[model samples]
Target: MTREPRSGCPIASTLDIVGDRWTLVILRDLLNGKSRFSQFLSSPERITTNILTDRLVAMESAGLVTKSPYQARPQRFEYKLTRRGEALLPILQEMCLWANAHIPGTWTPPVSFMARKPE
Candidate 1:
């Protein structure tokens, strides 16, 4: 299911898929080793369940994440970033750097996080 780009502009096109309020936050959670639905819900951002569900589905469709069933009884699943998703690591790292440097109240993450490269 390929989505039509909103425009030919590179940044705008990228934003079309990941520009939503919750998507990048979800991406951050995935990078920081959160995979389960409940784990995402536990983030300090306090995303509502419906929005989380929508973001996860959109991400999966965008090839940023893959969902696999982790439980059988009630059919629960876990999400993992694909290579395409992992490629966004640097973007997130830069965002953290910008926030830490420009946003006075922002918390700086460990150096290890900044050093991470997509695998």
Candidate 2:
């Protein structure tokens, strides 16, 4: 399903880039220091490999991440958040705070994570 871009609304434009459920989860994992594909697979939600690949590509294309090859034999890579992606950390924290307040049984984010300043 394709829709015309809404250039006027900042929120809508941002959502158009990172609206998928997995994108934010992937970003959250990156913020937690998970860099490898296997590490992302270890996330509790157990995202499928295919979706992860697609999202990573989309994110890279959007300048949110950059993947550096870590192993030559299999071309293994580690993904890191770009400055733009790192800027979303506070937004994610706000979401976490909102969830903790409204959702029963929601796990509280670590104090260290909430307290740390973005690089």
Point to the candidate with the largest lDDT.
Answer: 1
* Every model's TM-score: 0.96, 0.93
User: What is candidate 2's lDDT per residue for 1-119, written digit by digit as tens?
Assistant: 33455786989898988999899999999999899999999999999999999999989988899999999998999999999999999999999999999999999998887986778
| Per-residue error (Å), model 2, residue 110 | 1.1
User: lDDT of candidate 2?
Assistant: 0.92
| Candidate number of the best TM-score | 1
Q: For candidate 2, which ten residues in a row score worst on lDDT?
A: 1-10
Model 1, span 1-119: residue lDDT tens: 66899889999999998898999999998999999999999999999999999899999999999999999999999999999999999999999999988999998876777888999
RMSD of each: 0.9, 2.3
TM-score of model 1 vs. true structure: 0.96
For candidate 1, give the lDDT.
0.93
Which stretches of candidate 2 lie above 4 Å from their native place? 1-4
